[model samples]
Target: MSRLYLGIDGGQSSTKALIAKESGRIIGHGRAGPCNHVRTCQGRAKFFEAVSGSVNAACNQAGIDASTVTFAAVCLGFSGGPEDKEAHSRELIRSTKYKITHDAEIALSGATAGQPGIITIAGTGSMVFGRNAAKKTARAGGWGYVFGDEGGAFDLTRRALRAALQFEEGWGRPTVLRAVLLESTGARDANDLLHRFYTP
Candidate 1:
C-alpha cells in the first residue's frame, strides 16, 4: 500500500482537506464550513463538523475508508491558533505523525515553498508572518476581529457599517454607502442592520 498524507486548512470562513501520495501527487480535495472557534459549545460543534466533514469527503474521493485509514502524516493549520485545537483534532484523525499549527505559518510555508520568507494574509481576518534566513520567526496582527485585524474583510465591513450608522444619525455627510449597505443586507436602515448583526 502507498503512504498517504493529509493536509487541512481550517480558516474563519471554511475548512479544506487535501489528500496526497508519497510522491506528492494530489489525489483528492474537499471543503466545508468554518472551524476557527472552539471555545463555546456551538463553536466546538462547528469545529468538529467542519474538520470531520472535509476530511471524510476527501477520504471518500481518494477511495479510502475514512474510519479505517491511517495517514502516514497529517498537518492541520487553523485560523484561531492551534493550541486549543490539537486535542480535538487528534480525536478525529488517525495519523502516525501530526502537526497542528497556526494558519499563518502554513500560509507562509506555502507561499514561499518552505523557504525563509514573509507572507501577509487578509481573509476574514488579517495577519503577517515571517521567517528569517537565520530561522527566527515573527508575526503581527491577528488579534481577532475586535481589537485588530486591520486589513481583514470583517474590519472593512465594520468600518462600512460605522459610516452608514454615522450617516443615518445625521452626524456625517450623506454617502451612497448607506444606501448600498442597506440594499445588500436587506436592512430597512443602518440601525436595523446593526441590530441584526448583533443578534446573530
Candidate 2:
C-alpha cells in the first residue's frame, strides 16, 4: 500500500482537501462548506462537529478513513486567525494527525514554494501577501467583510447598487448592467429593488 498525505486548504466559503503521495503528487481531493469554525459555530463543541464533518467528508471522498493517512496537514485561512481561535484549532488537531496552521500561510507556502514573491487573492475577500528573499513575510488587506476588502465581489456589489440607484434617479448614464442585474434580481419595479441584495 502506498503512503498518503492529506493537505487541506480552508477558506471562508469552502474547504479544499488534497490526498497525495509522500512525493507530493496529488491523487484525491474534496471540498466542503466554509471552515470558519468560530463564526459558523456559536461555541467550541459545535465547531468541533463541523470540523469533523469536513475531515470525514474529505476522507470519504478519497475512499479512505481519516486514521489510515500516513501524514496530514491542515491550512486554516478563515476570517479569524489562530491566535484568537486556539480552542477551534485544538479541536481540529485532536481529530487528525496533521499540522494545522493559518490558511494564508499555506497559500504563501504554495505560491512561493520556498521562493520569494507576492501573491494577491481576490475572492469573497481580498488579500495581498508577499515575502522577501530573506524570508521576511508581509501581508496587506484581508480585514474581513468590513473595514477593507474593497476590490472584492462584495465591494463590487455595493458599487452596482449605487449605480442602480443612480440610473433609477436619471442622474447617471444608462448601463447594460442594469438590465442584467434587474433580470437576475427579479425586480418587477422599484418596490422589488430590495431583493437584489439577497440574489447574489
Off by over 4 Å in 2: 1-4, 40-53, 67-73, 93-101, 170-174, 196-200
* Model 2 score (lDDT): 0.65
Clashing pairs in 1: none
- In model 1, which regions exceed 4 Å deviation? none
Decoy 1 TM-score against native: 0.95
Each prediction's number of clashing residue pairs: 0, 2
> Estimated TM-score per prediction?
0.95, 0.76
Location of the lowest summed lDDT over 10 successive residues in candidate 2: 71-80
Write candidate 2's Cα lDDT for 123-148 as tens digits.
76778888888989898888776688
lDDT of 2 at 104: 69
List lDDT for all candidates, in order.
0.90, 0.65
